[model samples]
Target chain A: MSGAGVRFDGEAPAAGEEPQSTATLAAVAEAAGVSASTVSKVLNGRSDVSPATRARVQDLLREHGYRRRGGGARQSPLLDLVFHELGSAWAMEVIRGVENVAREERLGVVLSESAGRLTPGQTWVEDVLARRPAGVILVLSDLSADQRAQFTGRGIPFVVLDPAGDLAEDVPSIGATNWQGGLAATRHLVGLGHRRIAVVGGPPTMMCSRARIDGYRAALGVAGLPVDPGLIREGDFHHEAGYAAGRELLALSDRPTAVFTGNDLQALGLYEAARELGLRIPEDLSVVGFDDLPVARWIGPPLTTVRQPLTEMAEAAARLVLDLGRGNAPVTRRVELATSLVTRSSTAPPPGS
Target chain B: MSGAGVRFDGEAPAAGEEPQSTATLAAVAEAAGVSASTVSKVLNGRSDVSPATRARVQDLLREHGYRRRGGGARQSPLLDLVFHELGSAWAMEVIRGVENVAREERLGVVLSESAGRLTPGQTWVEDVLARRPAGVILVLSDLSADQRAQFTGRGIPFVVLDPAGDLAEDVPSIGATNWQGGLAATRHLVGLGHRRIAVVGGPPTMMCSRARIDGYRAALGVAGLPVDPGLIREGDFHHEAGYAAGRELLALSDRPTAVFTGNDLQALGLYEAARELGLRIPEDLSVVGFDDLPVARWIGPPLTTVRQPLTEMAEAAARLVLDLGRGNAPVTRRVELATSLVTRSSTAPPPGS
Candidate 1:
């Protein structure tokens, strides 16, 4: 049973169990009542079989458990990276870029994810290592500190995507310039001459959120504006949290005229809150967000946010991983990309006096 | 030098290789001039490190070539699995789900990809067994028939997704009930009173295309409409192909009032073509597409498409791979999932009469 991310611990085929052929092509064709050519195509990965015939042949093969050769002989790749929660395919965008570099280096990535809450954690790393995968990429965000260390301590070559902490250098790390992006967003709002500016972001402890806060502070300092910490609030980096933050800010006596959010998903929540409060965009409040994900364009008025090249980031990380597999030494490189604020209909000068 | 996706071959360690001490918590703490708890917290993947300190520690460790484990253990997971043309984390959708299943079943996947047409027929399969991955996923489409057969025949326990032809029973296969899905799409158009219907499909030789064409024919038969060969056309399942098909169909004297495309990517192409030709969606000509991907909803006039639960389908495929890995009989299970027809602004009773 070969699964996408499953790893086997047995030896490659010892000096023994070298040659085993279970069924002949002629036999499978005869049993399935198909011609040799038809069987040959089906067996070859050729797509010329009728659905009925395909189904019948597949049935026969499955029932008889007929394997032409009893042993495998292909040389497997050096690394496999399986990510979890890649549902929307957004996660894949990065891996795509990463795979290109990995291929050149002869590293293989078995892309797969862990189940809900039953994360691949320790067991996953151990199993993958046994297969002798040179390194691993955890498309992760919420791993506890201990688990990360355990994997690192186990001597597994691994990197975490959007990790919750700054792991050791032996483990390469790549992420967006959240702080710069935050500053860009705040500057965009401040440029509109808004005095009462509010900031909504994810939990304060998250590095991303902290970086955004730093950017917000920098933008304020550059603007000669006094930073009122009271205007800053934290959410869960989710739409609902954004909505709550939006509502709270809007209800304040000295309500903020402009707001900067940490992520697009959070920006969406603000949009909903505005609608709920009977407030129109731009006319009532100017908003900006970060991580211009694909859906950013679909939200009402098309969000004006800072962009993060997620694919590039993923690719860069993948390249680093592949380089590690190739026995190339990587420096402790922390790249902070430039962030640009995309202006859209969602932001405009604060409405009348 | 270890990186993501590296594999350990259990080869004998080189002579005179001295055992090295893993960076202990105390050492890292002393090296960084921080408290043991602080280093411990950082190493354990906890959240409390100040940005400055964290970055400093991480950088220092990398500069020193820190290895978390002393050299006794064998190097872990060196095997890699290369997929074909799966750009972005988009392909990871399958990988993640597959990984989850594989992890549970104690397997590891090494992800990789092929360039242009550089795959070495079935020779790669031989290489895979030699490297000793318990199983493989072929990714099905990227490999040739010979390669697929080589891997499968060798009992590598591969579960082929979107198999071109039929296989015997013991080999696992997973894909959508494409024929039924196609039928549903055609029926929707017919019920909408579209008589002069057209078809835009991928390579007709592909099973998915054939199933949809069959469904379209079935709907026409039920509607008592004769199939016009000229109104039907084949495509390469690309945007360009769909655009060409749409252009050709629209030029016909008896233009199709509605068209059903085989794939979402192609459907998007058809949409672009219709717009270029100034043919309004439902207002000018009805266009329905298959594979209701996320992009469908963002179009100016949201596309009317057949929604294939791609994520769910991926999950199912992943599960099948894991099940097979667990020594479950290789079952020829054809999970026929029902596709839903999503109606939006794109489809309407074809332009007047």
Candidate 2:
């Protein structure tokens, strides 16, 4: 859906017939022993409905496979973009991507942060329901099963953008090729005659991080180099974590000649660590990072990083959600855009080589 | 209204009596020769209303000083935050600040970018009117006179967060002490025995930039030093501008040993220029920057900069707009937060000293 910097790798599945709902609102209301207005209030997320009545109505709506009538008139000209955390240049790129789509669609973006939670709070869902946005694009965040059911019955479509961890296969999502990016980064170092390469990974809970680390190990295996368990370090994808890991790695009697970082921020931290220890980049200890953020080029010696195409991914997510909102079932539920390596000043051959 | 960094310099002008509206919807409809429903449609921003009738109604509304009865029930649980452009970590800070207030108040934030237009387009105004957010925050952007009047008639309160250029005296705004920041930065360099210091300024159209340059001139005058026009350069608060200015300044036969930049991004650009020319920070040049962005600390030599309290300013703007929306008059319409100089490794005494 993005205009640039994205390659689709998966073939679309054949389109299937749209599912027709076999139940009406009156029937559901009768079965739940509530007025039709009560069902409407629940659908609109009004807080006046009692919790027990709301729960009973929701179950009946799900059981009946009730879907609200879809049309532009019923939907507000807005798209909700929720983030796990809004802290870095990373989020800015995603926001820009969504804005690109929003501007074209003449829709406003309602932004929310989950405040470190993978799923947004109940209040956020209620607000989204009340606003009746056309669709929602979630960045590294998800909706609970009940939340998903609520939106499903109300005919609100949502697509997850670059989910940090693994998600249900049925969820519509967009992500980058982390495994390929990791393979490319490690291969470049190996081709440059780096045998003792240390790999610093992001949080273990994140599927993308695990995929990248797996790719790193796969590259080592194909290159006829033994993967050194001692050389592997884990970080939470922050500068301080990188610094701590860098110090631990460099303190060893036989430190690696190059370090592959989880992300650009970690690479920056490693830079600070190397500076404190009187080591030069490329000339002494080469480094490669993921997520070629803006600061990657501005930093001293410039970082060679994997381009994640974050903005493009976000744009794709927005487009997909809107399409779903328009009752267009996508051929593919999950799409991962291609990631490429951008080599700059951060990587070089081992000093002795 | 931020809990920190800001200082109240102006005493409150005594609160004036609230203006009372003598006209009713029926009277406006009678004057326009339209039904009461048509007047209601105009007030609700319904597109069905003819442009001629809508304009007439708006005129009557403003003429009547029609303040919609103030109440939470009439407003959506949302705050609109509009930006000139959503780029860079600078915007992320502002978004975070606004998010802080929005979360505390249990309101969603609707974000829009003017797409580099100093004033948002009419479409944005229409969308905002339709959304009926409790309040709006404009960052480095302004509303047109007509746009302001429309919001005034609708009783939608808005505040400018750090107006880039001069705004009307009546416009409520929050900004940092750019002049004092510039004075402090230049004074730091002057106190370090650097006489031939240069300053790189942001866009001349921006009032904050002008104030900082004025402060630079004042600092030079106070220290009994001559201001060199040849050493001064203008940039649009970007890295490339800083790099270009740095190159020109460094190539001069009698180059200055110290430079102060308008912002941190420019400072980073200057660092790149110095690096390319085989100049070392503090050893060959001393530099200072404005806006203590997160990257300042992560750079090679941590940058010395003026902390603009951007997040705090944004929070203040949000609070002020919400207060105005709740029919609470602000003591003062303008607020300036304190900017303090953070001395880091980027600045030192002149090379020869």
Candidate 3:
């Protein structure tokens, strides 16, 4: 037991598998007949190398399945962007927009959801802090006032996505103009010459749902129309609730000629309910939605709805996080991205107009 | 400016908020009119402090929003669990299962997503790793083999929820046995006196699709029934694809007496397509599905399906990550859980039985 070293490298801690015994960089350099640093440059594809030499090195590495490590730390002067999970196609559109800017900046991204819904005794903040991540993009899913304060107080440099705060003003955030989204949907219906326009919205407590209702009323006011109480329906953000609300609205003595739903999923339900009642979209009743989720274009008659600038929000969130990570002070300003009105087959002038 | 010494025993940074500046354990202790260590013990929920003392400390901290800085060399014990975006409900279910164990262990969690789909040149791993989380949970949608190997090589403790790995033997993974889920679904129909059962499945590249096909074959073998290649159909994991596949399968001269689909979403498509063809479920034909997603029980003529045990898988994944984090040299085992058949009105004895 003289002082000979016992190596604790890639050998087993009694693990039964032998598959992990791959060639290391040191071993490869020895066999390839080149210095370690020289081998590194060739493997990373960083600088000039003769074509024959590069091929020879790569072939040798391939023979032993040698993987070069530690290259991911190159530190591309780019932002690390992230997003909370939203939807399939809806998320993709936002990514497409963000990629254009990120490519220009040579930035990397890690799009991810914040921890699940804010509940008592559960928050991902502590763990997120441990990661020493450059900056954070937190998509707040209805956290309580206290939770918001705690998150903001930590001062990790973050931008809140799709959220509204009852917390004190120091927190940073970015979001689409949801109130305006509601207004646009209602105005589109009014432009179609419809008077009895009903609204199917999401949870009453959600900020987006409330803002949408405000916008809907504003558009109705602009058209010189009074809001009808019976035409309004509160819904959860899902297809089933949208269907139920549609059935209720369609059955009223004063049925609406048009209906505006809070999101595409709810709008899909509205479509189902209309079908059951033997109503054709736009022909018998006009339907418009908010957030214009991806499937809105592919399903049934393309839906006429307001589009949230998801990609812009993502890019903005990334930029804001970068600013925070750079030791700059928190940006107290809240960013508001514009939404567009997409006209499709789901809307038209009311029948007999 | 000669010899103007600066001593930073408890020196503050440029927090620049209140006149007192930085918000930290000491600052909160000063504001609360208590000792700093006392404040720390109270905030961390130590039991030695009197209840009255703890309450007083908590009340003062809450009154003036104070947060202690993390990342102070102790390192974060919190784990980051990432998933792809879809509906909040699905992610919530998995979280429920994972949190049940994580919280009990006093380990905090960080959440993230890979956005919708993988985009070219987006280093999602960078964004996630930047947090320097203790470990990671990749709730992968679909991953290429190279991607899986990259993490394995880094020695980062990770577990895949649903992997697309030919290297399953070498990776630490936990998922429902899809083929067994499929066989359970198919056998349910045969138990109800069904014959000529047809299948509607998602992209063949998906691991679950392959597992389901294996199950379908195994069930038929046990029943002593001849395998009919003509009865099989391919589909994407979407409602529309299921609808189209259902219609096409029904059009065959020797139409199936029952149907089996890869997922609840696809089964929903089959439901609509069957309605369009004027077919009554469990009357003209019986239908069964896999994945037993939330919507499976809510729709009309509620669906019968094979449940994938998502909850169990999430819990197991969390446990595995924790074990690895503890520096235990554990073997990478593919832990497979069981699936069950959920009976509902959508299935019955095939017609003319």
The candidate that wins on DockQ is 2
Candidate 1 displacement at residue A216 in angstroms: 4.1
* Candidate 1 local lDDT, B90-115, one digit each (tens): 35445555555545555455665555
lDDT of 1: 0.63
Model 1: fraction of native contacts: 0.33
Predicted candidate 3 versus true structure: per-residue lDDT over B4-101, tens digit per residue: 12111121122223333235556667866778777655543345567577667666665665533321222234556666653334465576566666
Which ranking of candidates, highest DockQ first?
2, 1, 3
Docking class of 3: incorrect
Between prediction 1 and prediction 2, which has the larger TM-score? 2
The TM-scores of all predictions, comma-separated, are 0.63, 0.89, 0.61
Per-residue lDDT tens digits of candidate 2, residues B1-353?
11121111111111221334324766788888888778776765556777788889888776665666532344667889999988889999999999999888777799999988889987788788877788999998998776787787677889998888779878899999999999999999999999999999999988899889888999999999999999899989888999999999999999999999999999999999999999999889999999999999989899999999999999999888888877677899899999999999999889879
lDDT tens digits, residues A153-211, model 1? 22344666664455555446777788888888888888888878889877765677888
Q: Is the docking of candidate 2 incorrect, acceptable, medium or high quality?
A: acceptable
Per-residue lDDT of model 3, residues A89-154, tens digit only: 455555555554544443433344443342323224433322333455555443444343333323
lDDT of 3: 0.64
- Tell me the DockQ of each model, to 2 decimals: 0.13, 0.26, 0.02
Model 2 misplaced stretches (Cα beyond 4 Å): A1-59, A70-72, B1-60, B70-72
lDDT: worst 10-residue window of model 3 chain A: A3-12
